[model samples]
Target: MSGVTAGVLDEAIKKAAIAWVSVEDGPAYALWCMPAENSIVVVSGPGEQYAPGLAEATRATVRLRGDHGGLILVVDAVVDRLEPGGDEWNELAPQLATKRLNASGTADDLAARWAGSGCAVVRLTPAADSVVGAPDLPADSAAQPPRETPARVETRRPFRLHRVRKR
Candidate 1:
């Protein structure tokens, strides 16, 4: 696999629909996010799924996937919260909500509620030259790769089928 570069990472962030993220060495989880000018914007709180405390997080790691399954971009991030109804939230909320394009009328309401005291909009900015490259595979990663299974071969005639009565 080729090592990730700044441009490649940015492009992956732009094209990816969801990201696997974690903060402060916490368990990694999937989150829906949007790529902003210089950072990735993620939302979490009471109503959202995988709500990590990004506001209080100092460090974060985000993994973005490409169209192909094996294309992964891993970046170390700095997590921060955008002020409720502030410039950053206002700018990114619409972009973030684009993922739920079929929400119809409910999107605005959801956005408003998320912008309220209940939820938080977190920005995960890529740290300066902090690209955490592809993860090293364990020794057993390919232990089961495409090996033939041993099986007994039946040389007798095909077994007869018995038809059961309809209940």
Candidate 2:
């Protein structure tokens, strides 16, 4: 990476509270993440956001948004799964939990439940030469249809202030 590109990537990764990660060239999913040890840490599973194919992917694309929520930088990243209870997990998990906002419990408590809850902690190490910023970003909006979900607004008759009809 050039000095400029490296600086931009580092700043973006550090300031971004959420990143759009596309696993195995699939659709990008917005996930909460933290910058740690020059890499990005993201957790996904039950009780957390879902990042399809992230748990098994060897590589992925990470897109960081600017202050205005527009795409600022795109980079290819090496995906590594942190084994629960291992050295890496022990080191990073608490940090991630601390970064998590509106969490129900203390950092230690949250990190403790992660393994049992089947959460996958993934580290995305940005590739040195894959940084693509402003001028090089694609012209396309990169929009996609929303994924299927069970929740929906229920259809019902509108309620009237009075039951009787006016003559």
Candidate 3:
């Protein structure tokens, strides 16, 4: 649907990681990284139902990559998606009153919950960093072996020549 391929996914994951690391506070919750032969998939779902689906997708991608010895990184964020009107909200209110915030805890809880939901469960063999990157051969890899050109054969047919004097 998103025209996502293995290379695209890997690039996306790298971008997300770069962005996440750039933030002063870092990501609020864990991020999923799945690498494939030609791409990688990165999913960011911080809420209840959404997180599970995203995690599952990430795990599946990782599994696929693993078959080819790809690499994946799952960064666990320690926060949970707060339900609009759930018991957790009530607890959060009291903690807010006490000036005790659990941003990391909240994220970790969500990650743990998603993990328990049977999401992000994939056994993949990690690949070297070099394996992940542009699919094109490096420009300096060496001039491409000279390509062989097919020989061309000429076939001539005889034609009668007629000479006409100007009238």
Q: How many backbone clashes does candidate 3 have?
A: 21
Task: List the candidates' TM-scores in order.
Answer: 0.71, 0.88, 0.21
Residues 43-148, candidate 1: write the lDDT tens digits: 7787576656666787787877777855366678888888767887777776676665455556557788777647777888887576755553223322223434
The 10-residue segment of model 3 with minimum total lDDT is 18-27
- For residue 1, model 1's alpha carbon misses the true position, in angstroms, by 15
- Per-residue lDDT tens digits for candidate 2, residues 97-133, read 9988889999989998998888899999999788888
Which ranges of candidate 3 are over 4 A from the true structure?
A: 1-105, 121-126, 129-167
- In angstroms, the error of model 1 at 2 is 10
Task: Determine the backbone clash count of candidate 1.
Answer: 0
List where candidate 1 sits over 4 angstroms from the true fold: 101-106, 134-167
Please tell me which predicted candidate would have the highest lDDT against the true structure.
2
